[model samples]
Target: MIVSSFFPGRIRLRNEVFKDAEIYAALYAAVGNHPAVKKIERNERTGSVLLEYIPEKLPINKLLALQSDLLALGKLAEFYSAKNKPEILKKIKEIESKL
Candidate 1:
């Protein structure tokens, strides 16, 4: 994952895995739902994740760590994709699109 931009209360990340809706959805469920996160936006076409958070509640270090973890999971997802069942992968993508 690459940090595309960072401002007072917002940060944008770019990652190839963001194009995979299933992985993106898991990222949302995990980090986007954090109490300190005010909003999260993912653009699959652009492979970008934009996050808005309450700076006072969530420190930059914590957010960075979360992003690092998410990126690591993305790598794992890529590995599993090569070996997982195709039907399961399709189902995950379908469910992710709904969110």
Candidate 2:
């Protein structure tokens, strides 16, 4: 058995994840105090927004799709900026390799 001291880890939020989170948070915030959506708590300890009330049965397929769309936005932003085009292409290639 593989024994380790590591507790369950959280999914690391890359820029793409943060972008998606920001979009989702903004959308939910606009609907403010809705039964299906709520502002994540601002945690003083980590200075991060904590989403603590997601229903256990909520499916994450849509969330994953949103994240993919946000990653595309990041690539688009890189393309429009002065950054190298190859870099964005390389990143997208890497993502494609994973799929």
Candidate 3:
């Protein structure tokens, strides 16, 4: 996790999985409703997220871990599976040629 910015009530973080819309949607759905979370914003082009939260309700390090680890592991698992499966590899190569 790369912390691009930090202040008392807000933090902006950068991570590779943050560029994935799927991850963004999941993160927003997972934490958007928490009382500590005041607001959340994302920039897909930069793979970055800006989170505004109440420190009294949620600690910053916990937020950082939750943001960086959960979906990243999912992406890593996806990469590992795709690399191991020959059937998926052929289809991926085929699609890559078309693109």
Query: TM-score per candidate, in order?
Result: 0.65, 0.32, 0.58
Using TM-score as the measure, which candidate wins?
Answer: 1
Name model 3 segments beyond 4 Å from true: 60-99
The best-first sequence of candidates by lDDT reads 1, 3, 2
lDDT (0-100) at residue 37 of candidate 2?
Answer: 36
Over all chains combined, what TM-score does candidate 1 have? 0.65
Best by lDDT: 1
Ten consecutive residues with minimal summed lDDT in candidate 2?
1-10
Write down the lDDT of every candidate, Cα atoms only: 0.66, 0.38, 0.63
Off by over 4 Å in 1: 64-99
How much does candidate 3 score in TM-score? 0.58
Clashing pairs in 1: none
lDDT by residue for model 1 (6-99), tens: 9868989886667877766766775665678899998888889998989887776665655544455445445455454344345444433432
Q: What's the number of clashes in each of the models?
A: 0, 0, 0
lDDT of 2 by residue, 1-99 (tens): 011121122122223322334433542353334343333443334323334334432235534644664466466533443354445444445443332
